[model samples]
Target: MILPEQFDQNELFVLTSLLIFYSLLFWLPNRFPLSLIILMMISSATVARLTDHLLSGSKMNLYSIMDLDKYELFDFFTYLLYAPFGYFLVYGYDKFKLQGISVLLYILVWALGATAFGEISLLFGVFKYKEWEASYSFTYYFIMISLMLLVYRFFKRSYKLHKVEIYNR
Candidate 1:
């Protein structure tokens, strides 16, 4: 997309964070199948967009992304920002093999971390709020990450079943 006319915190945050996360995405070992990575990114970005619509849309109007109160080019890139994070979230979940109550604790830790990072984004001008608080995003992150973990498990089971079927065939 187009860069902002001026180099500011908003641009710096999105671009720099995107670069960092994408680097981590690639640098990290392949802990998941390619399909799962694709799924995580798609669902992560979609959930981000949809929730932004609900909270930031004309009706609720909780916050603004980037510079303006309106959606801008960087706003789209900001969604790109969420994709790699989703992969890492589930990647760590699987790597730990968290079970039972541990799953709940894992989601809680991720939600807290996401909320803290989001506050960093606020400091960097990635988000400006009118009626929203960083605390609220903790709930959003918790629910979304929990859903992603469920999706990962479902996909893992399906992949195993499909592989076994093909091998038997």
Candidate 2:
């Protein structure tokens, strides 16, 4: 894991980002069940991978993650960065109980923040644009985040129903 020869700014960026993000997440009080937490973590990483695959594929060639155009070991670690992001996104949605017009404002704020984070990654050499602009991702982030919230509600409701059924039985 300590390959100083191959280690570069991109790798360092991922490591540092992971440390910071996970630390912040761990510091927060538990707001959801452990199973839901696990689900959100895995699903976020999965969504990142799937999105990256589609956008960065040869057909689109929108951008390159980390060093070369191919997916490197560092790229895998980069996806882990999304787990905490997804958690925070939905966490706030749940924690704040955002409703009505406030929900729209919340989504706008987060989409902007994510776009800004993407720009920071650009500065850190974590992403190289071929024909892509960071602005393009704002809409993508907005839609994805909205979907995540919906999924969270569905899962939360389902979990409650499941638990009630088990207890009643």
Cα-lDDT of candidate 2: 0.85
lDDT by residue for model 2 (126-166), tens: 89998999778898899988888888888878988888321
TM-score (C-alpha) between model 1 and the true structure: 0.91
lDDT of each: 0.84, 0.85
TM values, all candidates: 0.91, 0.91
Candidate 1 overall lDDT versus native: 0.84
Off by over 4 Å in 1: 1-5, 164-169
Runs with alpha carbons beyond 4 Å of true place in candidate 2? 1-5, 164-169
